[model samples]
Target: MTSTVLTGISELWTLDPALDDPARPGDVADAQVLRYAAVVIEEGRIAWTGPAADAPAADAREDLGGRAVLPGWVDSHSHLVFDGDRAAEFEARMAGRSYSAGGIAVTTDATRAAADARLRDLVRDRIAEAVAGGTTCLETKTGYGLTVADELRAAQLLDALIAEGALDEATFLGAHLVPREFDGEDGRPGAAQYVDLVAGEMLAAVAEHVRWIDVFCEDGAFDPEQSAQVLRAGAAAGLGLRVHGHQLGRSGGVALAAALGAASVDHVNHLAAEDVEALAATAARPTAPGDRPGLLAVDAGPTVATVLPACDLSTRAPLAPARELLDAGAAVAIASNCNPGTSYTSAMSFCVTTAVLQMHLSLGEAVRAATRGGALALRRGDVGHLGVGARADLHVLDAPAAIHLAYRPGMPMTHRVWRHGQEQPLAPVPPTPTP
Candidate 1:
């Protein structure tokens, strides 16, 4: 709870967009970008921020040597609790071949084949890479485990990581795909029965560990009806709902997600007119006292849209309709969608660049989408912005302006990172000994 003043920031992109008062929208688009700004951190929250000359005195001071300061990036969608690699499949897809939902089964096999120790290590390593890249908050899903035992194991792994203070959020994605062993050709069973088994048993077992449930609702994956069944069952089991919708094609997944009041409909690459209308309706919908929806309502929140640009970069897929979504009055968030086959990287910086360059998002829009918009997608009110009372999580940029993130893509711009008011130094690795 020590109060510290971080001075000598060349530029502070508060990401709050409110200069006069963070509660009210300010001229984030035209504000001087605050040269030589300083910030005060107290009790793991941003206490005050302004011109360096006006910085309040504190118990201690950490001069950043004129580095840039910005709120930490929040990655709201990722499948991080799995094992194995799909390099061959990725190479094939890069060589003019198409990707399908079935490719997920390959990773499923490998994840199920991995030992608990290995799986935990793999996830821990990925998360470390993300944190070093300035990702302060992230959401990871369990999709590779297609069976009851394997799914439970994935959940158990996530629980262990959480208990060990590794992962911040965990999701249950037991309906990621119809495993080959569950198909009729494999002499196992049918898809409907498999969905029921997952919804009834596997979901129940993992419910205690997961905060959300997701389904790959596509053509080759679970159909709309099947996906609905899984989501409904998960809701009945008290788990929040999310959907993998319209990444490959138009599958009515976005509309279905809005109907189910999902936390966020991810990969909305094929939204139709109805989908836009649905998003508008949801954003306009009012919530109750606690900002929770009424039981009978099925409205998506203010940030009704999420654009996963990394998936497009990896799979050669079309970018999400970011301009259309924003123009239609729907808030949008950006995520890495980090996975083995498609998005193998956990760099939110790359996602911001892709959003601005490929999806026509402005620099401010893309940054907001990566931070506050992501928090809205997750329905988390306290972790994305740099307002008072929010978590003291932030990233120090190596550049003087936030525009450098997109202006100079594919570069290491993160100078330092702080989580919960504590500065995290890079851990040293042992050097190789001479043979």
Candidate 2:
């Protein structure tokens, strides 16, 4: 059997709760042991994990040299595809101009004009950069390509990446905005028609490549009623629903997402009290019999409330209601929301820091949101925790504990990374001098 061992961990944040009874609730919110630990990997899955001294023997071993070990980060929301920059729009916004969802159209135009080669290259480079910084699993959305052809091409590129083992998750976001061509006399297409076109044609063309269907449900983008239609159609097409909600204003994005039972409602910068109540209500409910939810069933699974701190940092908008969500007992997740107009950085560490400092989440809560919460948001259980039977994906931090990820925000603290039982070289080491 293929096997490898990782030893000398200074601390391990398994992100799995230490439960009194393993057969009971998983206790996903409470972290498990923080003891010094080592992990064993076999056939790309975790075989054993325990105290360093008790680590199981493997065919080969690599000492981590007392580095902090934690599950590889899972970034559940991001718009990583597209071309061109929005620096000018950002500069203008900082110079007293208000932010508008209209900037998405500008990027849509540029993305439509860009060649497939350039878009693929940019996405590949960005994914590599994120992986080097400790992200083992990430979700990318295609929003800038608002047209059918462009959106399909974007999904094709994502499929190519996945086939080549470059990235993991891909989402189709044709409802990101109404392209200039569709901007009829009123600057938007007929709501029913738009949803039909996207759900029937564009979505069908990329259905095999995309797992989630996303829409920017804001005032200047698609309205609540329009977004609901899109969500319903996407549900019919067997794609999970995610939303870009309430970033610029209180657009009922949260309520809409909850009503439709979306996998996650992202960018909750304008959540209302009712929205908080809805999230908390779902959190208190028991999980459905099967771990996977039935497709198109309105009440199949709990809706995850995801906060995009990097988006707030770029748009200068109020932070997502993270504190209120947690206080109300809602299951919350944090993501980079990496895009051009707002939140262009892929640093989950920075996102965690913003959640703690600006959104008032405790260090532990922020870490949980970035790890287990992300997995919940993506409706997956095997990637964000270092439990046995999970994927052998982990991050080795330069610091001694997971809290340092937020404590030292802007520094490059990710020293090494491991994926599928193989340790990746962080940097080339020089040859040893002759004895």
Best by lDDT: 1
lDDT of 2 by residue, 1-435 (tens): 978888888888777533323332222334464567888889878888888888887898888887888788789998889788889999998897888888888888778887777787778777877777777878898888777788889999998887776677788998987766676667566655666788678888888888888888998788898888888888888888888887888888888888888878888888778888987777754434333331123235678889999888788888888999888878888888888888888888788878877888887778778877787777776777888777778889898776787777788878988776666655522322212
In model 1, the clashing pairs are none
Model 2 TM-score on a 0 to 1 scale: 0.91
List the candidate 2 regions with Cα displacement exceeding 4 Å.
17-31, 186-192, 285-299, 425-435
Cα lDDT listed for each candidate: 0.79, 0.79
- What candidate 1 gets wrong by more than 4 Å, as runs, is 17-34, 286-300, 426-435
- Candidate 1 lDDT, 1-435, residue by residue in tens: 579999989877776534433332211444525688888999878898888999999999989988887788889898987777788989998898988888888888778888787787788778888888888888898989888989898888887776765666688998998888778675678898899988898988999997778898999889999999999998888777788998889887888888888868889888787787787667655432234431212233542578899888788888889888877767678999999978988899889988888888888778888887777767676667776666778899888777898888888888998877877664522322212
Score every model by TM-score. Answer: 0.91, 0.91
Which ten-residue region of model 2 has the weakest summed lDDT?
A: 20-29
Q: With candidate 1 superimposed using the best TM-score fit, by how many Å does residue 244's alpha carbon deviate from the native?
A: 0.4
Enumerate residue pairs that collide in model 2: none
